[model samples]
Target: MRSTPPPPQLQVVAVVGPTAAGKSDLGVELARRLGGEVVNADSMQLYRGMDIGTAKLAEDERGGVPHHLLDVWDVRETASVAEYQRAARVEIDRLLAAGRLPVLVGGSGLYVRAAVDRMEFPGTDPEVRAALEEELARGGSGPLHERLAAADPAAAAAILPSNGRRIVRALEVIAITGKPFTAQLPGSDEEQSVYRTLQIGVDVARPELDARITTRVDRMWEAGLPDEVRRLEQAGLREGRTASRALGYQQLLAAFSGAYDEETAREETVRTTRRFARRQDTWFRRDGRVHWLSGAAADRAQLPERAWELVRDALGR
Candidate 1:
């Protein structure tokens, strides 16, 4: 009698896409269906007290799935993908060891790659970094960002011009490696997977996604996003480089500082978020490993089933 080989011992599922694409809800549904636990990859959602602005699901809304890595960082701490890679891998390993499926969910492309791909971060040079930081401090991020743009236009396009810290880091990397910052990224031919995984990207059309982003921003404002920022500010959010630059929080912080009124801040947040979503889509679409599922507004009702079908097909079940 011939017996079939056993299935792979570890299976990981990731639901990824732009913000306002219902990734969180689909993740919950996948976890429930697969008897899996959820691991959050959203960088902003890792900070405590950032619920409203980051659109983190409330406890009751989690549908009883155990989600790891949410609220893991204080708003005062800077986000580090290296640190996140270590922590997220630990959670994924734990889940796999327990014989439970792990569903990683978020739109943070780099974070997702750090978790599932064999990616290495470049070493930092204190002298070079300090010099860049000093330059940034004296002239602000604009000139340094211009330098980065000339050196690595793709990297610059991916990063927001207002992000001084990231701009400084990119320039530092360029100086250290004597290569474009994007060159350090995992190449299409060179990436290695750390797990046997299924990556499902939630796909939405541009016009529909733009409208959803606008509506989501409006809902955040009505959901007391300003109040949330006010509270986080008191907790030293402005001192945190990463937390202060989050989409809605940054705009609201500027408003609080009288740089702009609340209305202007809200409008700017919508505009910037729409731009950010496009960047996210660009990053994810370049990865051939992602199996995209329809996230169109018109296909809302069938999303979960369609996603599950993909999963089953992948597993050959």
Candidate 2:
């Protein structure tokens, strides 16, 4: 008798949403129920020694489920979504080959897209990139950001003025392609995904999310975020272009450097984080493939079961 063809790999399930929406716990619960492992998609969580501010789950909190891609990069190394995409796909493929589901989880929308979607990053010209970096160093991000705003208002709106690295990248892309940077993103014509994916978005009201963010930031401070930053700063965090700019770390570093007081840094962190959450919501809302599930704070107890129901429904199980 002829050998039979192997079974198709199961669809990759992704849990995504704004920060403070309880995605980590829900991902762990889903992995437990679905016989799956977790693949982290949060860009910040990929760095070592970034646990407290990123709200990374501890081992006990993971409930024995295997998690891949956490703490994969040093604080001194810049994070590349393309590199993350490749690494994440390797882990996902490994889990699938082992007959286990892969539950991809995080609030970083672009990283999630890079992992599962047919996303392609444009090649960078080193000369152009170097020139942009030099320009950024000499004049700061203000002039370049204004140019970006004129060239691609949407991209500029999405990127913060303080993010010098991204500002340079956008300008470089604009120069290389002779088109707006955002124009290269996957449009309706390029929606094909590499894996069979079931995307679940955790939804929370703005007020509740803002409140949660405040509480979480306060908890981070109580949990020794300052000390954590101090440790990482000794580990060369300030020299790490990407790692140094992480939400809480950036503000705390400013405080450590005497640019601001600790209280002001803490308050700015909360304010910027709330703004980031709004941007995350806007980004995910644009993707029509997401199946949104209510994740209100009051409904916390029911989230896991509700998430499981959504998964089962998606799979027609």
Candidate 3:
């Protein structure tokens, strides 16, 4: 008897994992072979002129495969999950209408969640947002976190002190809507099978990932990261909101402000990037959807093709 065939639906292949795991490269190749379009699901990579640090795929790097969402926003502008969801929905519809598979690639678990899940953060109260912004400007995150803790302790506990923007937004939502932020979010189970998603998680030994981070930071330095930051600073993109606080941008800002020399800033970038990678790993590990693969699990040269094969088989191709 012939083997049974898998069900056909809109295919959404998500490549999610820690940073420095070659997600973009794998996703690009997968799209090239599968006749799909790549949609960036990373928050930082969406910003224009953030090429090196965000590890954006160069024009030639895309190998003529169409990609979406890279350089979609100015670095000075904030890109929220809701905004990403909106843009991603449009792209998903376009790709599906074109009869091409959609490949969502990045380490931003939140962005991926926003794309696949139906979220309830649909409307925002301008009054509440303005009030929160005013309060944050005056007293900073301490009072905001306190307010969030009082109203929605779960959200308070889930968000970090360093994540001031999200914490403030959570409180602002609760203040205006009288609902827990988590409760406002749509059902997690709702996203599980919405789009025939195939989740691939790329992993590597911790030490190896750390080495990759170091090497990537060194490469960014060689690629004129200092000059890039100088240009952004000159363009008044230095400080405003969360986008300015991204890993390399913040470090380079520190260097620009004389907080550290170029060498020191680069080292700080690598160190903090590794920590960020660890946090990403922790977050993605909670996602049971991912099929984990190691970089050195096979030869580096053949690994991406092997990963594609695994994804193909997982999709029952």
Question: Model 3, range 36-142, lDDT digits (tens) per residue?
Answer: 99999999989888888788889999989899998888877876888898899899878987888899999997888788766657467788788888988798888
Candidate lDDT values, in order: 0.92, 0.91, 0.81
Q: Could you estimate the TM-score for every candidate?
A: 0.95, 0.95, 0.87
Ranking by lDDT: 1, 2, 3
Off by over 4 Å in 2: 1-10, 188-191
Whichever of 2 and 3 has more lDDT, that candidate is 2
Worst window of 10 by summed lDDT in candidate 1: 184-193
Query: What is the lDDT for 244 in model 3?
Result: 73
lDDT tens digits by residue: candidate 1, 83-166: 999999999999988988999999999999899888778889999989988998899999988999999999999887878998
User: Could you tell me which 10 consecutive residues in candidate 2 have the lowest summed lDDT?
Assistant: 183-192
lDDT at position 234, candidate 1: 98
Error of 3 at 283 (Å): 1.8
Q: For residues 173-261, could you state the per-residue lDDT of candidate 2 as single tens digits?
A: 89998988887676522246888788889999999999999999999999999999999999999999999999999999999889999
* lDDT measured at residue 170 in model 1 versus the true structure, 0 to 100: 88
